[model samples]
Every structure is written in structure tokens, then in C-alpha cells.
Target: MALILSQLFISLILSLFFSLTLLPHATTSKANSSSEYSITSIFNVTAANHKTSQILSFKPFHNQEEFPQTFSSSSSFKLKLYPAASLYNTHHQHKNYYSLDLNASLNPGITTGTSNFLVQIGVGGPPQKFYMIFDLQTDFTWLQCQPCIKCYDQPDSIFDPSQSSSYTLLSCETKHCNLLPNSSCSDDGYCRYNITYKDGTNTEGVLINETVSFESSGWVDRVSLGCSNKNQGPFVGSDGTFGLGRGSLSFPSRINASSMSYCLVESKDGYSSSTLEFNSPPCSGSVKAKLLQNPKAENLYYVGLKGIKVGGEKIDVPNSTFTIDPYGNGGMIVSSSSLITMLENDTYNVVRDAFVAKTQHLERLKAFLQFDTCYNLSSNNTVELPILEFEVNDGKSWLLPKESYLYAVDKNGTFCFAFAPSKGSFSILGTLQQYGTRVTFDLVNSFVYLHTLCCN
Candidate 1:
């Protein structure tokens, strides 16, 4: 049972997930072919003539102090999102994926916190590598195969499938075994699935279709995945959970990528290292937004905010508070495993009363869990504070500094407003409001850009 990023738990929202090692899909040739889009992997880098994207270099999950940082006494701090945060603990129920965030707070109590995004792929027909948990909200990609009965603990070894040679399984009349998500039809015909991971964890698995090479590029073949064999949750060091949703089996609609970029870099105690670019993005265009498409939370990525700013004023809010209803509930999302930012509660009390009327002599404190506003600052005060925008609806706005809405709680030395409110009306910008920034994600041209980092 794996697939997560309930990195948003904060009692407000932080969701994160993992619990994998999926693999089982085999058919070879064509991944939306035209010659597998002109072969190339390991991030080969190319743009003008296209067909050369296969960039890779993002691997940081060396435990990082285990995550899940929640406290209360020293004055207050909490990051619980599960039944009390969980990113590991599997050696009987099986858990060696101390990777992605179960609570994603390396230690937000102050310094080293929030991190999730590991990469390294290659599966079958002789390829092996693994690592996973890239998740743009998952679509279908799995691993943890081998002659097992109940697997787990996969840092390496376990993908065997008779040493690749283009492994296979799909059976039940292909079409990627009916796009598993609660599928069925086994008895030995294969295609069986079960899924279920918004944190309640679940997995039955069978759906196969291997051969997805990538050290940087080329080796498409067969693709479709999810060969769990057995799984639980937490997925520590990782072994599966890749998908970069939009459906059609994800991975940006099977490598069609008209766009893709990532850069969160800010490291130095969180020890950072990031990269996830495809199809040119060291910089480009610089402004764009309009991704909203929540088929009832299908992989998550909505937008259309339109309200926010402090320095220049403009806390008008209510454009339906960002609109999205039709039952999918008011929009807002950009969570790479959410770290903070959650608005929506009367638009966060009218943007926290317009930032407490511009810091009225700073002092407030008391609502711990979803942070009402929190405050402390004083030491050599100069305090100009103000300049915090978010307005997105063309007239453009995404700025927000002051360490992205504050947050220092040096064990109660105080300083937080890392932003939080939503009990659940949908709103989650997280990733600490996307630190250094630089997020592309064009999803074949439906929009999504957000700048700042140039590829750090």
C-alpha cells in the first residue's frame, strides 16, 4: 500500500506518501513512438530540433534526520499530518523507503526541514537503477518485483524479472491492464490492482509493462507499471512512486513534454541538491499560470488565485476566494509535498487581517497548530516588513520574500507565519511557498511557470 505526499498534515495540510517498489509492465517499442521520440536519456539536453530531453540530477534522501518534527512545550511547533506523522517503520510490514516526506519537516522547528523529490530511473531489459518518488501527484509507475511473496526494503535488488530482457506481465488484454485504480481480473490473467494512497495507504498490484530506461535518456518500450507484489507505506529510502500526472499513464503524458522544470535549491543544513528539468528551462518566458483541472483531485495541480499583496497593499480577496467550486471545492495547489502556506478560511482571515495591520509593534502568539500569526522578532529591529504577493490572473504576481512568509521558531525564540489556515476548503501552495522557485510544468501547454531560481 504505497503512493503518498500527505507532506501536508500540519493539522492544516501537508500530505506526503511512499511505500513502493512497483514494476510489472512489458510490451517493448513505442512510448508514444515516432521512434521513441528520437531516443536520448540521462538528460541529454536539446531544444531547437527538440527530441533530446533526458536530464537528471536530483537525489537527496540520505535520511535527513528522519523527518516528522512535532513539538508543543518549548512554546509550540507541530507538523503532524498522518495518525501522527509517518515516513518509515517497515521491517515486518516492510518499510525501507525513508524517502519522500510523511511529514516533510526535516526539522522546521528551525533550520533543516522540508525536502522531498528523489530521482533515478531505469527498469528492465537489462536496466535497473530505481530510487523514485518524483510524484507530480502520481499517475501509475511501480516497482519492487522479484520472486517475492511480501516485499519491502528495496534500495536495490528486487527488480530481477529474470534479469530484464524486457520483462512482461499485462496479460488481461493490455490497454495497460485497464488503467488500474481499483481494477481486477486475475486468477492468473493479470491486471489486478487496488491502489488508494492519499495516506490511507493501500496496494494489491499486478499491472505490468516494463522497459523504461533513463540515466539521462532513450529506451522507452512497453512502460506501464505497478508491480508491487506487496507494500505498506512510508516508503523511506524509496523504490517506487514516480508518475508526473496528467494521465495517459503520466510521465508528462508518456514523454511528450512540451515543458518541464524544477529548482528548489536553498540548502545548507537541509543539505540540498535539486534538478528535474526536461525540454529546456534554465529560464524562459518567465510568466504564466492557468493549470486548474481537478477531476476531483486527479493528481492535484490547480491554480487561479488572484488576491494577495502586502507591501503595495491590495488584500481585496474573494474572486470566489480563488474559485474552483463545482464541488472540487475552491482552488489552490502547488504542493511539491507541501511544507506550509494553506489559506482559505475567509481567505485566511482576510490575509491574516492584512498582516496584522502591518505588524503593530510585533508581539502576538498563541494559536500553535495552524498558526494564527505567531510573532516575536526584536533583536536590533529595523522591520520594514510588507512585500508579500501572490496574485495570479495575468496581471502577474508571485513574489513573497522575508524568507517566504517568515518561520524561525528557533525552538520558541519565535517567528512564524510560515502561513497556514485551511481546514480543508482547498488551498495548499506549500514547499514553503516554493522557496528559491523556478517551477515550469507546462503539461504540454496548459500553463504553469513561476520564476526565481535559474537552475541552481
Candidate 2:
């Protein structure tokens, strides 16, 4: 009888194992009575043209407290922008772009680098939090998703779409799918997207419409974005990127925002936060400049840069050096990702020479990184820096603060000018130059408003 009992127990264990294998596999619990969607691996698709095989149903968030109602017309929200270095303990306090070995491949009027600012937002139905790079150069926002075949290591858990109740795949026939560059329809009729940055970083995945929630403004439904299953890059410490570009797939365009404003605080502590306001009115006493559009690259934010001034003396560079050609070759772009101001080679030479001439009394140091202008002022505490200004739109002088143009390399008073020459003819006015200022982009009026030293 004892031998028969042992045999019976073994038989029961085999039966249980088989039952568990036959049961449906799910990453998370079902939201409601609806059927749970199984996570589909990208490798399961046999067709050569097919990218992804997953299909998801749309269901509202069960927790109402996590996702509030849709935003009203006049309602506005603020997102805190933190320095990218704040997320990691080992990140260097000062990031000099010249030290980086960026990719040599070039794209038209586009350059990529390690983003300077990061913003946190919620994705999916239950509002899974994600830290993303807040970049103005990216046209489409994307994040790493589960079932990732190739993905970089991130601090947070990978976004699992199968677990989200509000995840919906976009069809190939939708107009939004057409907005993606080099997008194609999978064999299952789902829209697939692939984006490659100039820095050799790329992501490939299916287009999705998911719920995105902001901390102060509640949540927006069916926001179009990329759920990347295959991704590779050095994305700093962020999970993905939030694109604020003018493209149709950008966050501002997806939400139909008429205006947006961000104030970058001048702080090296990395933990200090700044504010990014959407649909906000221009700040009082702000100077307005006519925003220019590059027909070839409409997603970029271009402003008329008439000239540059050092110590109140305008540099003697041809005005055409800053003008955009008909083919959209040369133009000035206000970039939030770039840490240092970059100008065309000839234009930069003139500006650098003018700065050197004005600071002749200060002792000069060897060129540090890409910066040709470095000064050793170890003994001086109150040395006056040359006032730097940019002439924009009909001769409006936008004065730059001292911290914008000067960077202290070390504690011993080795300072370097915070400017560089662009790889191409196009110039970029980076965040370093815009610090301690409020930058407002009025899309409806096609204007950019600048308020100096207004960030508190």
C-alpha cells in the first residue's frame, strides 16, 4: 500500500506540470473581465517584411486616482526638468561635448548628443513611470518596451505593453502612421517604425497609441508614440526620449499645443529642477523674435540670427553666414539638448577673435577640448567677463549672462569659453547659452520669446 501511494503522488505531480504548461501565459493580471493579451515575441513572426506580431485592446485605467480626466482647453501643466546627471551618482558634474566621440555619420540639419535635461512622465493605463530625455531635436518620442530583442540597460523596469490595459496598436491605414519616417506596414496590418539618430543610436518597434499622464495636467488619452522592442544606444541614464520637435508625431503636435515654454535654471548641482509649461502665455517683458521655418527640415526651431556682439562690438562676419540657404543648409537652431553654443566655422572664428581681443588683459591658457579660448584667472575673483549678445529678428539684442559664455573647468580658476564650431554650416544655440532665461515658442504666431534671467 505504501509503494502504491508513492506511485500515485508521482503521477499527480506529472499531471500538475502538464496543466501549468497548457495554461495561457500573461505578464500581468487582466484589468477587467476582458481577455488577457499574451505577450507576442517579435521573433515569432515568420514573414520577412513583418516587424511585430502583437495586438492589444484599449481599456481605460481601472484606478481613477492615477489617471485624471482629460485636460480642458485653458488648462496647462508643468513638468519638472532635471539635469540628466542627477539620475546617476557617477555622472561627471560638467559634461564637455568635445570629450565625446560622436558618430561621424551626418544627417540633414540634424545632430545628436547626450541630452542635458530629463523629465519624468507616466505611460500606459495604470500610469507606469518613466524617465525620458527631454530633447528638442527628436521628432518622435519613444521608449524601450518588453520582449526587447536588443535594448540597452536602464535603471527602471522595461515598459511591458502586455500588462497595460490602454495599449492599442496603430493600423497601417491611419494618417498618424504615415507621419513616421521610413515606416512600413507589417504583414498583420500594424504600423512599424524605425528611427536612426545621427549619433548611430537607433530604435525599431511598432507604433502605438497609449495613455500618457502628466503630473499636474492629469492625463491625455490615445497619445501616439513608439513602443520600441529593439533599441541600442548610449541614452545616458534615461529610459527613452521625449521629442518636443515641430513634427506631427512630437508630444506638442500630438496634443495640438499652440505654445510651450521652458525655463532652464542656471545650476550645476544637477538636482535642481526647472519648469516646462505648455500652452502658456508669453512672460511679461519678454523680447519676441520672428521664428523662421526650414522647408527642408520643418521640425527644427529656427530663429533669425542677424549677428553676434562681443563687449558691445558686433563681429565682422558676413550676414549670409548665418542665413539659411534656399536648400535649407545654413541656419540657427535653438536646441535644448546641446550643452554649448555652436556656430559655423567662419562665423565662430570671427566671434572667438572678438572675444580674445576684448579680454587681452587676462592671462590666456592652452586650448581646452574644443574650446580655443581659455583663460587662467586663478588670482582674480571679480574679473569682469566680456558681455556676449546675439542680434536677432529686426535687431533685438538678446544679452547672455556670464555663466552662459564662461565655464569653470576646475576649482583652481581654469575657465573656458562655452562655444564650439558646428560640424556643418548650421549653428545651434545650446542650453548653456539659454540658461537663466525663459524660452517660449508660440507656434500659432510663429515667434520665439526670450526673457533674460527670468528663471527663479
Candidate 3:
């Protein structure tokens, strides 16, 4: 079936408040144990299919050089997990933000969108916490505060340079400063930088450093991510992003060095779950995420997809059709996280042909053919269309449940939903597509695997 495409513009805004208070036990978990631990894991079970194949079109734009290029291929497996830095009430203040805990199975302990945290700018006598987004896409991290002129209102937290005792800025001439995409030399002898998000939100500031905490294998450890003096976002709650990219101390970086490993689970509908694992001998050898060695160059990574099948029928889903990011050192790894959508002509063509040829049954499980309606298919409340079964990459083909087609938002701002082809087209599988089972990514070996699937 061909899909109809349409464009709709919608503006969404949410409000949050903040209050600051000092944390009693900042280093409690890290200072105590060394046994293997797990991160958050919340994988939903359900299945729905979409004729969506349009959201995957990542075109080349003007600043193409600024962005990385991604390709597809495969290799081994590995998994690793790091304790995400906590962004609770460590600083003394009040804020209107919701705190979601991390799961040991799939979910990472990250507060979603515009949420910032407060932390001391630099290591010294008195440490202060500022609110910032711990953005995975971003490399350098900074805070918006008193020092930044007319910074966005984020409760009591602001990067007030005048108030900080040790506010040193990077020099424009420094090679390290130039490495930042937005870094520029300012007239005031301080390195200046400005970063803009895809949604047009931006943050500008000077560079600095601060301690960030995350569970490494079992114990909590303080690592330094970027620190910005001036920062901005549509929403504000957390302090700043702890870089998880391929940089030195970020999650990908750690996985690369220590060969960290992890797993993720995706469902036929649109929900996901994951688990991160890491095992490094203290002061023994180096470890890193094995899967990240030859990344796609862009924000996307690769996880060796085995196969997809429906009702025991194997379907041919190529690796080139979707983007994947593998994590960990040298073990089985998976991720229930993916931002893929079926939008491209080539991808849609594949789905159209697949269904046109192999689909033996066309069932409309719920909802009206037109309009925003709802229905109950065999006792299950359904929103849109009925359930269609097809095989995944090739591993094990099973029934794509109808309930998996719904959507939800998780603690880390991980949102899952299904987008079929417009009025008459196919559907796209996205992060919202991976909802159940344990998805694993092996950075060390470079392979993607699903632990198990929910049966209907």
C-alpha cells in the first residue's frame, strides 16, 4: 500500500519550576560497592505496525560539513552500563521539574527535555550547581545563570560569574577550545562558544569543567563533562548533559576504552527498553565501547540487526535501510532506542512491495477507517488500525501485537509512538517502535540483538 504524506506545524510548550537544596549524600553509592550493577529497565509488551517510511530521510544541508555522515555495516557484540549522574535536589533550590528514577533493565535515569541540574562550575573550595541539559547530541555542557545577560528564567539557578569564586575561561588560542564546534575567540581573552539545537533552541557561553557522577559497572564515579557559563533551552530542569558521545569521558568514550556493553528491546508497536553493562578491572587495563569504533560519522550508530519475521515468515530488512548505534566493550549489546521512521521513497517502496506480495491477510482491528475514533478488537481497546504481523530482521518472526502500536513518554524523555504512511501510505518504525524485550548493543564486537519478544 502507498502512503499519503502531509505536513502539520504544531507548537508545544511546557512549564517547570525549581528550588535548590544541598544533597546529604552525593557520593554514597559510588563510595560503597564494586559488585556488578544494572541500570533502569522498562520494556513494554505490545505490537502494532505502521506504513511509515518518511521520517528516515536525513538530507544533506548547507552546514553539511558541520554534521557527520552515516553509513551501514556490521561486526561483533558487547554491552556496558554506567551509572547516570543523578540530577535530584543536590543544590539548595526549588524547581518545578519531575524526577524520574533510572531502571535496571532498559530506561536510563535521565530527565527529559529542557531539564537542567546545578553543579559547581569548577573544582575548588565551594562548589555550586547550575541547571543544564545533559544532551547526548551535544559535546560541551554549560549553565545559564546570573552571569548570562537576560538568561532564560530557571528558578534560583543561573550562571552568575560574579558569584563564582573560580570562573576561569578557556583561551581562544587553545587547540582544545577550537575543537568545540561553536568555540570562538572573544575580545575579553576568554574562549566563547554558542550551540544551537535542531529545534532552533540555543545556548552560548564560556567553557569550563565540573564533576559529573555516574555508575561505572557498580560504583559511582565523578567524571568531568563540559561546563558552559551561558546556556538556554525551551524547558529547564536538570543541570547539564553528561556527554555520552564518542568523546573522552562520555558514555561512548568510556565504552570505547573499557569495552562497555548494553542491550535494548523494541516492540512491534512503539515502546523500548534497554540495559547497560560494564566490567573494568580497577587500575588494570583500559576499556571502551567496542561497537563505537567506526561510527556512522553522524549522530547515528550501528547495531547488527539479525532479521525480522512475521508468523514465522522471514522478511528481508536490510541494514542500509535503518540507522543503529551499538554500545559496550566486547559482549552482547542491544538498545531499545531508535529514532528511525519510514519516510524515504526507497524504504516505503520496500514495505509496499513486501505487503503487496506476502500479506495474506488485511485486517482492520480497531478505529474507524477515517476520523479520530477508537475501537475494541477482541476485547483490546485499539486507537487506529488493526494489527499486522511481519518478521523482524531475521532472528525470530512472531506476531506483531495490536497493543504495541500505542505511545508513551518515559523518564529520560524517551517518547514512543507509531506513524503510519499519511492517508494512504505505509508506516515508519522509530524509537517509538522499540517498546518491549531486552535490546542489546555490543560496542566491542559491533552487533545488535534482542533478548526476547512478547508473545500474543
- For every model shown, what is its TM-score relative to the native structure? 0.32, 0.79, 0.49
lDDT of 2 by residue, 22-70 (tens): 1223432421111223322111112211111110111111111233434
lDDT of 3 at 144: 55
lDDT of 1: 0.54
Clashing pairs in 2: none
* Alpha-carbon shift of residue 371 in model 3 (angstroms): 12
What are the candidates' C-alpha RMSDs? 22.3, 20.9, 15.4
Predicted candidate 3 versus true structure: per-residue lDDT over 296-325, tens digit per residue: 232224333333332223446444433333
Give all candidates' CA lDDT scores: 0.54, 0.67, 0.32
- Which regions in candidate 3 have their CA more than 4 angstroms from the true location? 1-135, 159-168, 215-226, 229-233, 247-296, 317-319, 322-403, 408-429, 435-456
Error of 1 at 343 (Å): 15
Name the regions of candidate 1 deviating beyond 4 angstroms. Answer: 1-84, 90-134, 148-168, 171-224, 228-244, 250-302, 315-333, 338-357, 360-409, 416-428, 431-456
